[model samples]
Target: MLSAGFIVAVVFSWIYDITPGGIIRTEPLPKQKLPLINKKVKTYRFTTFVSVIIIIGLLSFNIIDSASARKIEKIDKTIAVLPFTDILPIKYESIVFDYIGNQITAGLSKIDDFNVLPWRSTKNFRKGNKDYVKMGDEMDATILVDWKAIEIEGEKRLTIEMIVAEDEKILWSNDYSIKNSWTEISVISTEISRNIARRLRTFLSLEERARINEIPGSPTALYNAYRGRSIAQNALYLYEMGNRKTDLSDFDVAIDLYTQAIQVDSSFAEAYANRAVTRLWGIYTTHYSGNELEKCLEDIEKAKSIDSNLIEADIAMGFYYYYGKRGFDNALKYFQQALEKDPANVDCLFYLSLVHRRKGNWDEVAELSSQALENDPASALFYINIGTSYDYLHDFEKAIECHNLAIAILPEWPA
Candidate 1:
């Protein structure tokens, strides 16, 4: 029995020795797990994640905003005011019509943002029986101001309507009525001007409105200096319209008109400049050379002596240097100078592009052509220059592309 007990005890000791160490162990170890995260740390982590997200969103928004700004910057806005219609009741009231029309025109002229047609041109518009839409297109007018004055109950009532048309579609229109009063004519004129300006402000900025408001008026001279200036301007317009025979007579008339204007107001810079152009035209179209050219130069110099800031004088000098004398460098210098004075001067830009092309400066030709295009995108001559520039640079495909665009814009050669 004792030997059997000994055997059992020996088996128990072997089982205990072969058992895993943790199962046999009796003492418990101290817990060593990390403490639960505090609310502050969790809040910090969440805030950091949100801040990172916000930063990324802000950066993306800025990038998109900058791209949108660039696109908006490229858009250009232009406006033109059409000729005002004469609204007179009687034949004798034509003089009244002229006075009222002149007043309205003078008021609108104060605003610089708009290209206002001169009263003389507007008056001549009725002579051709031209369609108002076609006239608007020819004059590049975006807005038309139609006005009528009639006797209502033996009292004069002036009705004025403003229309904005593109492709003959009326975009906006408004009517204004005013009673005639000679004593308050200036006040009435100023009111009409302000209303027109306000309507324009819907599309134009304040600065542009101010520009339209600053147009100068005819000086109070017995001879009507502004009227004389208008006659000279019309003569040049005729010359540009290619009526050489008529233009020559008009030039003579312009000379007389400008001389009268200068007599009335010696400080009339425009009269001197236009007279210089008229004199230059005489030398150019009369087949006069040598002494005539010298005479033309003297006349232009006198014009410059009268007003150093005249753009026409610079243009005249440039043309003389380029076409008459073939002095390309001098021509380019004067052309560049004129462009500096008026960046939107199409004549100067066109001449400069031509001179650059002649000088084999293809880059400058392209640059000047681009500037001219900005001023007059409808001009086929500018596109032709662009195409030629590309052709000279061996960019045949681009040359053809530009030529095609030019042809598309102006289908006929003289168009």
Candidate 2:
């Protein structure tokens, strides 16, 4: 109330004068015209004028600040890729569709013009008849990549469209027919990237253009590598899809897919790491014993040997130490290392929080879980972790608030 009265008094004094004899007078302020300055004679008028001008300037600055924020929001270089609709008779052709989607996303990620949403982030939208606009809004993206694929005889037909999320307008569309070979997928991806980049009119440097046309060493090597890469990608797609089932069957299908990936690419470190992660899950369920455990450890070690800097390998090590060896400190160390490599990684932050939770470090748990939500806000697990941390800290109100947020994101889950 005191602050409010002070403000009101200041505002009233801006256009009036007060005398020492307790009289309020409506006296016009005298101005002395001195060269480039019309200086006010009264101290109150000078101060009030300066205050009013400052207030007006602040209001103008706020208006511009709001407008600039809106402009920045509309100028986001973000896009979401919906899983390509497969209209083939073969049910298993879903893998091909997924692989094609992956290739296009990977190709576009190479361009500096836009950011492609991760597959994990978009896969959950495969429920019901998804509204493109809602998905785009949820992802905070301006563009949506809606695509479809059809396999006819020995050729594949692909159709892709870019929709402006705000107005549901088609920004660009293309239809292409090519040989149903693995190499052809990359060809389609590059052509689509080039066409979309041109439509966006983003200034592409010479080097970026050159990347769009990069070729393999030789035709023979290109054929094998592309084919192997697609096979591995499709297998990974299967693994990811199956892993969402929330049952032991997830391990079954994901392991088979990883095996297929290894068969196609003998030196695939990522495939090894993914397989080892599933194996770790199996161990947690008491499904792997003796020789099987040894094999899983070998796979984890082999993945680290192949790629010393693989984040997935680091995550696998973290999990191995936590679940298999019961070494919480070592697990936390590796998880922290992985988080350092990719601070925005959802799994890294969540798993690191899990370790903190185990150690009864409620502060650390809350911090890590909150950080995970920064990258993947839709993750109900992270919210749950935060709620659990609050619960441990005896903050029931905050715990309830965090749980409410989790419930809002995943209403069906009774966490």
TM-score for each candidate, following the candidate numbering? 0.49, 0.64
User: What is candidate 2's lDDT per residue for 1-415, written digit by digit as tens?
Assistant: 4344555776787666778877576765456644443455466667877886787667667777667656544556687777754455654445555666766776676677787776545545553565767777777778888887766675667788988787787878999886645446666777888888766656678988787765322222333333443443333333333343344454566677676656666666767776777777767655565346676778888888888888888998898888888899999999889989877677888888889889888788777766776665455555666677778878788778778877766675465
Q: How large is the C-alpha RMSD of every model relative to the true structure?
A: 20.4, 15.2
Clashes of 2: 0
Winner by TM-score: 2
Error of 2 at 350 (Å): 1.0
Whole-model lDDT, candidate 1? 0.60
Clashing pairs in 2: none
lDDT of each: 0.60, 0.69
In candidate 1, what are the lDDT values of residues 127-154, reduced to their tens digit? 2676556766765666666666665665
Worst 10 residues of 1 by lDDT: 215-224
Candidate 1 Cα errors over 4 Å, as ranges: 1-77, 83-160, 164-195, 201-250, 293-306, 377-415
